[model samples]
Structures are given as structure tokens and as C-alpha cells.
Target: MIKIAVVGCGQIAQRWLRVLTAHPKVSVTALVDTDLAAARRLHALGQVDAVTATTVHQALALANVEAIVNLTPPAAEPEMTRLGLTLGLHVLAEKPLTVRAAPAQALIAHAEQVGRRLMVMRNRAFDPGYSAFVRSVAGRGPLLAAGETFVQLRAPGFRTAHTALADLGVHAIEQARRLTDAPVIAVRCTEHPAAHLAPHAGLVTLLLEFADETVVSWRGGYAGPGLRTPANGRWSADTATGSATFDGQRQLRVGDEMVELEPAAPGYELCIGDMLAVLTGGSITPASVSATDHATSISVLEAATLSLSTGDRIQLAGTR
Candidate 1:
């Protein structure tokens, strides 16, 4: 069993605790939050019976863990992951590796320089719901075009300007890559500020043109004025042979057949399993999200943010 320290006992941390504590190969050795009260609340609620600390430094001292499950807010993720990587522990971080592309890319480079395993959690690819869809695409050839959407009544931490594209849209970008296996060549974005709130871009529509000539359009809502009615959710990817559609639930349809998926382990569980598999002699697959791809997702979002701010499509560097 790999001893793991979970950082940030907030909303995401709750999920981590539930999944990691029960896993046979994982040990939730420590929990940390900036607010001791919040950390204590999760500790008591979970009945984890483990060491708890209010900071990463303190947690590291107390727990002899081999990995860090970082569920901290987007801004804190890079530093937290860096601390663990610096200490030679593998890190599985939540989406949007950092607030910007450059920092995220820097972390990836640092991880490589130090020879550590770094993975960003993109569970949609591992979701059992899409297994048949994955199989369908095997015979169909390269993904031609794709779309991924996530509409929520409110997006967490998106109350600030230019945050919606980064906070929520990043996941969609990852989804597009997972299905399409292409890099974003160009991006066009349109965003609207939240109603009755500070000039935060609460809603965003992104057009990502991929290297495989597959264009994935994605969009979502944040804590804005108000969410649009019937203004939520959709994903469809087409190859020359066939197309697949996600019902935004667990259902996906390819051509005329439907593949229903029973709920598998929670995303965190699958993600931790993926990390441990690699750490314990599991090889990385072509389908897996790599450090480079993770960084590119942030870059695409950064381009979208720039596109929205400039009211002009941004052509990503080094793509045709």
C-alpha cells in the first residue's frame, strides 16, 4: 500500500477521503487544509483516524507518505504538487494544473527534470460509460470532429473576471484531447460577464481547432447573472465511419447501438489507481493524459481567455 497525503480538505477533498481511505492499495496517511477548522471537520466527518495538519509543510513532516493527492484550489495546486515532486513523491493533481499555461508548463518541465511521475486527473476518459465509444472509434479511425460541454447552475470559484474559461472550460479541453488525440491548433472564444456581479466572465463558448482537422467546440456557465434555461450540456464526436454522442449522463450512442455503463469507481479512485499503477511498474498508455497534454489544455484555455479579452481568435503558437 502506498501511503498518501491528501492536501486541501475542502469540497474536492471529501471525495478524495471517501475513495482513498477505502482503497486496498492506498493509505490516506495525512490530511491538510489552510483552515484547521475545515481540516478538522473533514477528519471528524471521515473518521479517518489519521494525522491532520493545517499546511503542506507540517503535513509532510508528520506523514511518511509516498504520494500526494492534491485537491487544493486551482491557484494552490502547482505549489502543493511541486512540494511533493521536490520530495520525490508522485502527484495526482486535479484539473487545470494551474491558473495559467506557463506555470503549468513549468511544473511539467520541473517534474521531468526531477524524474517524477506527474498526472493530471482527466477521469472522463477512464469513465466506463465511454468504453464502447472507445471501442467504436478503434475501427472508425481518427477522430474527425468533436464537441464537449459542461453546464452547471454555478461553477465554483468562477466569481472573478476571466475565470470561467479556466475553471470549467479546462476540463472540456481535456475531454476533447482524450477523444480526438489532437493538439489545439487555434482557438476562438466568446464570453459574457456575470449579470449583477463584478465583471467576471460567467459564461464562455470556445471553438478549438485541432491538429487532426477535428474542431471541438466547448462551453459552460459559471456564477454569473443567471444560467440560461435549457442552456446546458452536449458532446458529440464524429469520424468518417461513425459518430458517438454523450447524453451528458453515463449514456453514449454510436451509430444505431447504445452502450450503457454501470457506475464504476469514483473518478478519484480510478485516478489514484492509475497513478499507483504507474508507480508500481505500470506503463503509460497512448490514451493516458501526459504532462505535455495537461499543459496544453491550460494553454488552450489561456488562448480562449485572450481571445475573449481581445475579441479576436488567437492562433496558438507552433500549429498550422
Candidate 2:
């Protein structure tokens, strides 16, 4: 069994723990959180018989962990992942990878130097519905894409107008990249005030132009007072051949035909399963969200944030 340490005991951590504890080839050896009681609570709820620690050092001292599942907040992810890689452990982290591209690239380089795997959870990529949509649009030279998300959220103090893009919209950005199979070369973003949310929180819209000349328009916010969208949001793309749409309800419409989608486990379960496979010597596919691939997503988000602030279309380097 691959002995793993789960760092961070937040809601995302709970979801990951459910997958980790239930997996036959995995064993959760330790839980780490600043709030020791939170770690203890998850340890008990998961019934994994793991030790709890308030720090990564204490967790490492207490357990023989070979890998780290980092569910820490975005700010803490880089340090946690860097420490894990430095300690000769593989790391699977939650998204945004870091809040910016430079540090994410640094972490990728460090993981390579250590010869350890570093992956970020792009769980949407593993969703059966989204997977089906990607397959349907394969080889169909996409031209225009659009994504929409609306949900009522209780604004946290840390969620600001700029941070909300990475916090919530990164998924859509990643999805657009996947659909177009191209690098985002430039981005323009705009934020509008939402009366229902905190002053810092607003509805965000972005226009991303990819290297292949494909463009994606994305809009999302936490101000859906009466109407709420699915967590995955709604995605559509226009291609040379036809148009394809995913309703975020496991339903995909491709031109005149409705693509059939098989029901699958939750994204967390599928992502963990793939991670286990990789740890067991299986090859990582291009679709897998490696740290290197996710760095580009971080770059797009960072550029979008800059655009939101400067009111200028931000251009990215290395998009060729």
C-alpha cells in the first residue's frame, strides 16, 4: 500500500479523505492541519486510524509517509508541496497550484530535480460528462468557446474580487484550454459589482485568446440570487465541423446528436484512482493535470487578474 499523509482538514480535504480511506491500495497514515482538532475530527470521521499533527514536520516524524495529499489553501500549497518534494515524497495538490505562475513553475522545476511526481487536482477533467464532451470535440478545430457559472456563495473574508477568478473560475479556464487544446496567449477581464455579495466580490467575465486563434468567453460569479448553476457550469464550443455543448448535468449535445454519457463516480474518486494508478507505474496521459500543465492554467488566471486590475489585455509569453 502507498502510505500517504493528508495535509489540511478543510472541506476539500474531507472529500479527498473519503477517496483515500476507501481505496484498497492506499493508506492514510497521518492528517496535518493547523487546527489539530480539525485533523482529529477527520481522522475519526474517516476511521483511518491515522495520527494527527498540527504541522507537516510533526506528521512526518510520526508516520512513514511516501506521498502527500495537499489540500491546503492556495497560499499554503506551494510551501507544503515544496516541502513534500524536498522530503522525497510525491505530492497531489488542490488547484490554482499556487496563486501565480512563477512560483508554480518553480515548484515544477523542484519536483523534476527531486525525481518526484507533482500533480494538481483538475478534477473536472476526470468527470465523465466533461470527458465525453472533450472526446466529442476532438479533431474538430474549435473556433469559439463560452462558459457560464452562477451560484450563490457566502463570501469569505479572504475571497476578493481579484482572487475570485482563480478561486472559482479556474475550472472554466482549464476546461476552455482543454476544449481548444491550445495555449492562452492573451486575456482581457472585467468585473461588475454584485449587490448581493461583499464589496470585494463581483461578477467576473474574461475573454481568453489562445495561440491557435480560438477565443473563449467566460463569465461567473457568486451572486446567483434565485438561479444557481451546476458546480461544473455550462460549457459550449463552436468548431469547424459543428457545435458542442455540455449542460453541466452529464448531458452533451453535439450538433443534432446527443452524446451518451455513462454515469461515473465523483470527480474526487476518479482523480484519486488515476493518481494511484500513476504511483503504481502507470503512464500519465496528456489529459492528466501534471504540475507543468497546471502552471499554464495558473498563468492564464494570473494574467486575467492583472487584466482585471489594469483594464488592459494582458499578453502572455511562450505562447508560441
Candidate 3:
């Protein structure tokens, strides 16, 4: 079995633990977190018997671990990812890769240099909602137009005046890119503040023009004001063909057609499985990285954030 180590025992880390524990091909043999208590909690959740560490180096020294699952915040992501890659261990990191596109690209470069796999955890693609989306466009050819909305309810850390597009828009943008395989050539964004902790309750009316002549419109908010019906949930994708809609959330639509799915695997589980497969000398495929897509998707979100703040259209530079 492939042995794994989890770094950063946050909410996403817990999700990774749950999914990793369920996969028969992998075993989470170690845990690491800045907070020992949090790491203990994750250890308990996974029912793991391995010792927990307070740092990446400590975890790596354990000699039983083959990969690291990084669930840390964006601020700490690059450094942690660097550690894993330098140690020749595969990494499955939380989304947005880093706070911006530049550093994220650097991380990818380092991984390539070291021949270590770096997979971003973009589990939304594996979501049932996204599954429905893929089926809608599988054989239809290049898409003409697409749109997405990311809505979530009020919770602590829900709203901020100056928001990081990497946190919210990355999901929508990446999912769109994966679905369309088209690069976002241009971007424009706007945000609105509210009474919440952040000035803006939510954002509205964003646009991304793809190279394939596909225009993507996106809107998202957390308890955003002026909008009827507060949509408190994770990001979701949708697509349509002559009013026959395929929603990432609802799965089957209009008479239960079988939407082709790569599989129903969870993100962390898929990440771990792919890492182990690589250890056995296998190649990585889209299905393996279905939960992960780095580079260009992150650039779109970063560019959008820059646009939202400066009131200028930001073009993604050096996109892969």
C-alpha cells in the first residue's frame, strides 16, 4: 500500500483525511500540522495509528511516508509545496495553488525540475454537479458560450471588502477551463460590499473571453445583498444546449440520460491514488488530475482579482 502524510490539519485537510481513509490503495501513515491539537484531531478522524508531526521536515523524516497532502493557506502553500517537491515526494495541495499566478507557476516549475508530481485539489470537478456538465458537452464539440455561479452562505471568514479572487473564482474558472479546454484571453470583474465583515457582500457580473470565441460569464457572493434568495453553498457549474440544461449539482436532467463520468472518486482519494500509481511507474491522466488543474486556471482568477480591484481588464500573462 502507498503510505501518505497529511500537512495542515484544517477543514480541507479533514476532507482529505476522510477520503484518503476510504481508498484501499493508500494508507495515511503520518500527520502534520502547525497546531498539534489539530493534527491529533485529524489523526483521530482518520483512525490513523501513526505519529503526528508539527512540521514538514519532521513528517518527512518518518521514513514511512511517500507523499504529502498540503491543506495549508495560500500564504504558506508555495513553501510547503517546495519542501515536498525537493524531497521527491508527490504533493496534492489545496486550491488556488498560491495567492497569485506567478508563484503558482514557479511551484509547477520546481515540481517539474525535481520530477515530483504537483496536483492542485480542485475537487469541484468531481462534484456530481460537474459530472452532469461534462456529459452535456462531451461530443458536442467546441462550446460557444458558458457561464457559472459560485454562491455560499454566511459563515465566519465569508466576506471581505478586498477579496482574493484566488479563493472564490479559482473554482469556477478552473472548472470552466477543464470543461472547455480553452484559454481565457481576457477578463473583467466587479464586486459589491455589504454589512458583513468584508465591505463587499458579494461580487457580480464577471466575464472571461476564451480563445475559442466562447464567452464565460460568472457571478458569485456570500450573503450578497440585492440578490433575492441567498445561495449558501459551494461553487457550481452549468451548461446548456437549446435549453436542455446540464447542472453540476443536479446530475441527470430531462429524462435521466446517462452523463458519461470518468468516475465518482473524491479529490484527496484520487490524489493519493495517482501518487501511488506514479510510485509504481504509471503515467498521470486527466482522470487522475480531474480533481486538480494548475497554471492557467489560477492565472484567470488572479487576473480577475486584479481587474476587480483596479477597475481594469487584466490579461493573463505567461499562461500555460
Q: Which stretches of candidate 2 lie over 4 Å from their true place?
A: 155-161, 193-195, 198-201, 318-320
Residue clash pairs of candidate 2? none
Q: What shift in Å separates residue 172 of candidate 2 from its native position after superposition?
A: 1.5
lDDT of 1 by residue, 240-260 (tens): 888887665567788888877
lDDT of 2 by residue, 65-122 (tens): 9999988877777898999999999998888788788899999999989999888888
lDDT-better candidate, 1 vs 3: 1
Best by TM-score: 2
Candidate 1 local distance difference test against the native: 0.70
* Candidate 3 residue spans exceeding 4 A from truth: 126-128, 138-161, 197-201, 224-241, 251-281, 287-293, 316-320
- lDDT values for all models: 0.70, 0.81, 0.64
Per-model RMSD to reference: 3.5, 2.1, 4.3
lDDT of 1 at 289: 43
TM-score of 1: 0.84
After TM-score superposition, the amount by which residue 255's alpha carbon in candidate 2 deviates from its true location, in angstroms, is: 1.5
Q: Ranking by lDDT, best first? A: 2, 1, 3
**Reference-based TM-score, model 3:** 0.80
lDDT per residue (tens digit) for residues 1-320 in model 3: 77788888877677677767776777788889888998898777778777799987887677488788887777787898888899888887777677676787788888888977777665665554554555556544455444445454455343355452556667667656655656678899887755553444455557877766566666665443344322212223333543224444343343345443444554445555565566545565454353235666767777887887799987764343
Candidates 1 and 2, the one with greater lDDT: 2
